[model samples]
Target: MKRLIPLLLLAAVPALAAPVAAPHVAARSFEQLAKPLPLPYAEGADADAAVAAAKARARQAHKLLLIDLGGNWCLDCRLLAGTIELPDLNGWVKRHYEVVTVDVGRFDKNGQIPAHYGITGRLAGVPAVLVVDPRTDRLVNKGHETALSDARSLTPQALADWLARWV
Candidate 1:
């Protein structure tokens, strides 16, 4: 009976463990996403000021800073923007992050933004998402900066999952 009780307790341990919840994602496929995807990067806006403001907001809100370094001309960047703006995902993002989009025109402009995170030289690709810890002003997801650079090839849910991983 003692041995049986121990086995029963071990079996119950699995059930007692809390399940990790998957991130909320509304779009299952690319076609389900909104048409004429949003151009999130503002070419004329001051990228430095925007990042500063976002960092401030993130610090105050106790949220992470999500710096989206990309260009309006990039299709993948647009795709990532549109997926993030999905009604459900947008709300989730707002709850967890302060987002700032900086236009890196042909990877020529906004070089300093990525450099600020210790990512020198040319970037891997557009939509280099710098997940920052606003409290410390440090990049959280360092090596994975360009993980979503090929957003076009991934499903919206996959993108949402990637964003959620930082949180």
Candidate 2:
């Protein structure tokens, strides 16, 4: 029984030692990838009212409203924010969408914002993005809620391309 115990343990070692798969992050140049920073989701504010204000601005600007739904604790969410803030893309984003970061605190805060856009709660994960046409009060990208949730896996160029597609 002692010999059998050693063999059993040895057999289990490989399973335990197997490497976990790393998250898929697309390659990017240092200049292309913005440095990660703290998420800038406003705390204790009515998300709906904020979106409404953004919608009004979008209407006047003849642009779309981008409602970014996520929280400060979400790494992917922060990554997306940084990627979008890159100088080249940041200007493009400003020209195209009135961006608003709605903090869904650990999925406990402002969940209704997604529901308002027909996303229920979340699409795939935190950092769900919705592009809304202020002119029509309609969701432009309905099924692509999780498009930017994997910002770590996407290069800055890829993120820019995605944003450009909507415009």
Candidate 3:
């Protein structure tokens, strides 16, 4: 038993020492940020259609559209949204991309889109961005790939740059 303990401890060392990189941040030029991303999406209240577009785009070009899913009263959603609507970012977003704000009942008293979209977690705390490709409706990214789902770190400009890279 004592001999085995030494081997087991050695094996665990690698797992504990893995490098931890800080969350990714994009630093693109302001001028580039202002330009339209050149990807277009069809719009309606139909989330299925939206997901379908995601699938199609994913298959064809490996692109994902940013989906801000939240109710009106979620504070983080509020912060993320308020940041996006700031004049500089807002103007850029208005010209360069398609934004769909889904009311998933976090802030709203009785919204149904959250269930329709198969969401199973916090509705308001979610700055839940579904980067879905339109060609095949595949999901490319959801805010973060961390150990805990509580790791979404996106600024409107940083998010805009991330989306641009895929498109």
lDDT agreement with native, every candidate: 0.87, 0.76, 0.45
Candidate 3 weakest ten by summed lDDT: 143-152
Write the residue-wise lDDT of candidate 1 on 25-54 in tens digits. Answer: 867887787888888988889999999999
Note the clash tally of each candidate.
0, 2, 16
- Evaluation by lDDT, superior candidate among 2 and 3: 2
lDDT, residue 93, model 1: 86
Write the residue-wise lDDT of candidate 3 on 2-62 in tens digits: 9999888877864344433222333333232333321222223565555446445444543
Best-to-worst TM-score order: 1, 2, 3
TM-score (all chains, Cα) for each model? 0.86, 0.77, 0.44
Q: How much is 125 displaced in model 1, in angstroms?
A: 0.3
Candidate 3 wrongly placed segments (more than 4 Å): 1-64, 107-124, 143-167
What local lDDT does model 3 show for residue 43?
26
